[model samples]
Target: MATSPTTTGPRAPAGPGKDDRLTPRGKLALSLLCAAQFIIALDFSILNVALPVLGDDLHMRQADLQWAVTAFALPSGGFLLLFGRIADLFGRRRLFIAGLVLFTLASVLATAAWGLAPFLIARALQGLGAAAVVPTGMSLLTTTFPEGPQRNKALAVSGTILSLGYTVGMLLGGVMTDQLGWRSTMALLAAAGGIVAIAAPALLTDSRPTERPKLDIPGAVTVTGGLLCVIYALSTAADQGFGGLDVIATLVVGVLLLAAFVVVELRVAQPLVSLQMLRRPTVAFGNLGGLTTFSMMSSVIFLLTLYLQDVLGLSAFETSLVFAVQGAVLVGTGTAASRIVAALGARTTLVAGLTVQSVFTAALLFLSGDDDVWLAVTALALASVGHMSAVVSYGINATSGLPDNAQGLATGLVTSAQQLGITIGIPVLSAFAASRVGSLERAGEDARTALLGGTRTGVGVDAALVLVSVLLIGFGLRRADRR
Candidate 1:
């Protein structure tokens, strides 16, 4: 195999004469990639609304019901980086198509599952497929479109579809579970996956680096094991809190294994990921921005779900309607994200987006029992504009100035930040709210009011964290963006 030295250093933007327009093939490619992304996002959330109904039907214990969600999340979050690297070495398109087959088959299995054990196994297989698809799809996009306005626009569209998929899944899950039964939710995923799998081969071109560098076995094992442990521990913490012996022990082991992975990568000749890539301001701050926006925003949604349903007495469908508003706002924002990056550059767009998100999220502090729940809806809608813009810009920033050969590694970090953010957000932030609720209850407050207080505090903290991140990311990336 022919080899070129890998370089992740900063590079100048495309010259004025370079054509930034997309051809017809580009449009079709974008459509296929976006479809894959939508299915991945949909699978992540579609099961939430159907969980209780599915649990009763399957005769699952209440304590074990959370596993339905965790089982999918674990492999999806844990194996992202490893599979991402594999896609680069083996073949992105090949792995992507293979992932679709696995995902589609798993969905069918989940739909036809006769009991709890089979269902959980099928869900894990679905997650494993998702692990392969997400990063590979992203890398394909990055490779398909050059690093410029064209790629930025494509990413904006992809990110918008991702947000819409989650929202639609929430709403669709409720309607499907109510009208067609809980199994119908899994069937829907199977149908969507089948369609995408059939289309993927023709639409996607095979891509891999010229150099077939040896896979870093020690690094891959340690990192994959570390991530699995941490994700499992965090998922358990979400339900059981951080006080459980198992959760604490798992977290400790996870951290130690991750530390060892870092050490192994440093010594290995063909490291799974180049630590020096982290030295690039765009990669470093971009991942940081992505992690914060995703984590904090997701935490806010989880908090609102409980508050709206438990405290305000809204039905599941009604709560979905409130989120639908945010989805609409994101759609509008996505249309403008590329233009915003064109005008302000990715770094400024990122900082400005986070600032806007923080300001509106702060508005949620005014929320109380007396106020209309629409107050929460309004805040989220405004915040989502920032959310969508940040999503687009962080992606551009992260993948900027890297060689095509390293695009997979760059996108792996990008997708991993996103996956881990979503996984870690609910547990960590909800724990804060839970603590506040416990303290208030101990102080003789009523259950409803105490819960309300806890939710408010959690929202406030989320706002503050995002606000602080604005400064950190801005300063960190100041030198990275010269445009």
Candidate 2:
């Protein structure tokens, strides 16, 4: 259980032979990490702008389109903890580089894909690569920067870049899909990945546990399979109705498997995630709070995109421009969030952000079919601010209390929770909307009328989720501060 020497504290002032003024090497490493984060974040939004184009070009059905998105999300969500533990046992640097390479290759394959199956397979590979990169990068940051101001600042910069990446991705995806084509967007991402891969080897120092533990195979299988099943079921429910037998069965099996995972972790010598860490008020509450906030945020974006295009009749380019407003606010707020957290404390800042977010979410429910565009945009922008602020605060707090060596697992768990929230949120909310729409249709409503009613119902459900998230965050803040 030996820790890296760097985790000890500030080292002696470097002499001429040892230069360390945020050495070129360190800067390069940070750059690679930031680029990796940007690419991963970009993947989340890039497809939004390209989906229509991809569908038209490939003759894809609606179900195929849904799979295109879910294919990436499910694997990324399912494999994070397993890969994070792998990174800890093997080498973070090695895994990070390998992930970069794999992602880049996947992007190339996707660019060349002429069929639905190939494209989806490529996306799944990209997801697997992302699973490796995120945890490894976080682990590297945690190991490189000792706990305190330096680590906090590093996390701040990383978080800001991550948010900015999402904004840039949406804008770029729109422009590229409109002008150059969807395939070109994949090529661009591949190029970015290549750049990261080239820089990673020189900048990242290989590190491994002095005494590595055995791989928790049973825990890994149970958790990964369980999460995959859950995500698959939820995604299925979105496409097929809530009463779909396959969806219900998959969800039931997933729950049971996850319960088995917990039991396995408790009895194993080296658990994939240490149950003891979850006992910590800061870690546990921060995760729950993050889960709630991300779930609402993810579902809101999904519903809003459909509403803007289908209900409001906005074009793709125009819709993307509107989405960019929220991205701008998110980046602006996220940059300053760390300083705000420092000044006000994590609990205060988180609570404030969550409360504001809830207010904005509720406000969206009042938007009528005839509402002004400015009003809708303003509400979305406010929600983005709150979402980004809370996310940054949670990221900082989640890693603060754990011992240095456990930071990778903590980061992975946090990321997994956020993904799980989104995975669960999209299907659940989509199902609510679809059911409501069905009821309205059964009442003899027209298709267009049903869609409008469904969109409103979806918005209402999202607002409710936001309110619940706010309450959970408030509870988490209180619990953490008391500890």
Candidate 3:
């Protein structure tokens, strides 16, 4: 177990009875942390709207376009544990600030990129920065706020910011890409990262590590390579088919490598992830639940964006607006979710949220080209509300049971699971959609008509995925209850 350095020289008299909210300094620090979080969240969804523009400008094929997204997702997904451990071992504030610098530099480079290779490299760099931000931000928040209501409130606010950033990113990316061009969006991201970098040193207090852990180099390499291989295998399967020898071999190797990583962690003196933490009911259930939900959510967003643009004849701006409605619902619900969690225990909230999301997603099956736009938007908003509620509840549960120093590692693990889910889910869903479309086309549908059918099939698959996610959550909750 590890502990953070407590504020040793604190002698300020108690302010009133109990309503001792954040001090002025504490409020500023929270603001800076939220800003960093917003940047990371915004980066995740911002590129979706810009992808087409970037593809056209850079003369990239669809396969290459996927790389632009994967380049960011894969590294960010895989390196979280490694970076989170670094934050805990060295210093949270140090790694946080360093990550900001690296992220900002990457954004600047990406903004200036003229070719696929440079842009992909820059995106990978940005992902590395994001890998640090998620865990470190949570660690800082947990340490800053005392336990009970105040900490819950802070967590709620952080969750809201995370959801809000995704919404704002879609709208902002659309506007930037339409007016200023795709490159300008990256430049704006750089500017935001720079601001965070400058504010970090001033607002964040340094805390020395309680226990310095040795770097698990072999574990890091094994896990990272395994994750990348798995993601690559799934991604390639979308285009090349799962029957390809390359896909099979890559997936096999990835699974073996990941198994090796687990074995290594169990034997290591200072493990990258503390396996003991996974034994906690709340931590384990929350992580698995979060992973399932996020996986379905990411695939839904990807498929829906495609459906909105290709089948519904929506411009990128219009598509972004549609997602914006969902985003707004996510923000509003996420901000209030902690109260809900307090009222209903985490297990109940998790189950309820997952159930609601499942229903909302299933409602999409009723949609068609002739359906009312407002009705579709309503369903999306409902789904968003349920989704954010689930996320915030799970997030609070995942971090609450852990010790302060372990917060980073726990957060990282949860985040890594979610990313891994997305990496695996996307290609599987895409392949299913392709298969459905092919079946329809073989039944005499025209090429254009078949493509439109494919979009609808993709949405259906997304709905099915959400249902499966519901089951996963329910199973995890049941397991927790039994324990």
Candidate 4:
């Protein structure tokens, strides 16, 4: 086993006593960490509203617009595990600050872009920075807050703020795209990242592993390559078809590289990800549960956004408002999550939350060309509440029992699950829904009706995914009880 960081580095301070609720230092830590997360969240949602506007402004097609997102997502998703391990070996604070600076600089470059290449390059740079920041910031949070209710409360706040950022980004992206230009989204992120950067050094202390493990060169190389290939494959599959030779080949290579990565990790003295860590029940199930929750939640957002704008002909601003309400629901539920988790246990909470999300997603099947809107809107809001609650509970489960040095890996695992899920889910589910639409259209349905029907189909599939998670958790909990 790897050595603990008791004497070697600035490990997280002991948990705050009840008497010290939101002390000055605690507030500062929370503020700083949350701020980083808030900015990252902003970047993710901001682009969704702006993609069309960007395609027009840059004189690019939908293909190029997808690239703009893929450029960012590839590095961010691909390099997360590697960067998380690096943060553990080197210093979490060091990587966190560095990533922030890099992200801000790229945002500036993106904001000033005049054409496709510069914009795509800048977005990729931002992703590289994000790959470092997400896990390291999360590591800092786990270490700073301690592993109990205090940490749960802090994570709830982070999840709430993060969900709020997505809401804000949607509204902001629409307003900015309408009033100024799509570039304004990047400008907004740059401004937010700057403020967080200034506050971070003052609030965060450096924490590194006690005995630095030699970088697992093969593990890092193979895993990074594998993830990059996988993300590329997913993006390609989403854009093109799975039948495309390119997508199939890329996906095959990704699977092979990942297999190689696992073998290397097992053989090596210092592994990028400790396979032993993956054996933890909470860690394993937390990520699987979280993956289903996030993927399904994000798929709902993607399909609904398209249905609202493309099918129902709602303006981007109006669509943003609808999602804004959902965001509020998420924030509210997140606020109450700590109490719920304490009372119910993370496992129980996870099951309940997943069940709620599944039910609401299934409710979307009630939506049709009738454009009642209430069915879609109500279900979305309720689903957001459950989704955010799951996020908090999963964060607690994944990191709760992890040691200080392993915090980076724990957080990285969950974060990777989220990114990969979003990346994979939107495409897979969307394709299924699109197929349904095609079938209906071939059978003589109107375009609007086909779109509405397609979105409903996607929502149904999303519900199925969440329901599967519920069953998985229920089964696992039953096994644990038997033991």
Q: Best candidate, lDDT-wise?
A: 1
Instruction: List the pairs of residues colliding in candidate 3.
Output: none
Q: Candidate 4, which ten residues in sequence have the lowest lDDT sum? A: 1-10
- Predictions in order: lDDT: 0.87, 0.78, 0.76, 0.83
TM-score of each: 0.95, 0.92, 0.91, 0.95
Where does model 2 exceed 4 Å of error? Answer: 1-28, 446-449
Off by over 4 Å in 3: 1-21, 421-425, 447-452, 478-483
Model 4 ranges off by over 4 Å: 1-20, 480-483
Better of 2 and 4 by lDDT: 4
RMSD of each: 3.3, 3.6, 3.0, 2.3
Q: Which of 3 and 4 is the better model by TM-score?
A: 4
Better of 1 and 3 by TM-score: 1
Model 1, range 130-176, lDDT digits (tens) per residue? 99999999988888776777788889999899877877888888899
Pairs with steric clashes in candidate 4 = none
Q: Which 10 consecutive residues of model 1 have the lowest summed lDDT?
A: 1-10
For candidate 1, the per-residue lDDT at 144 reads 77
Best-to-worst ranking by TM-score: 4, 1, 2, 3
What does candidate 4 score on TM? 0.95
Q: Give the clashing residue pairs of candidate 1, or none.
A: none
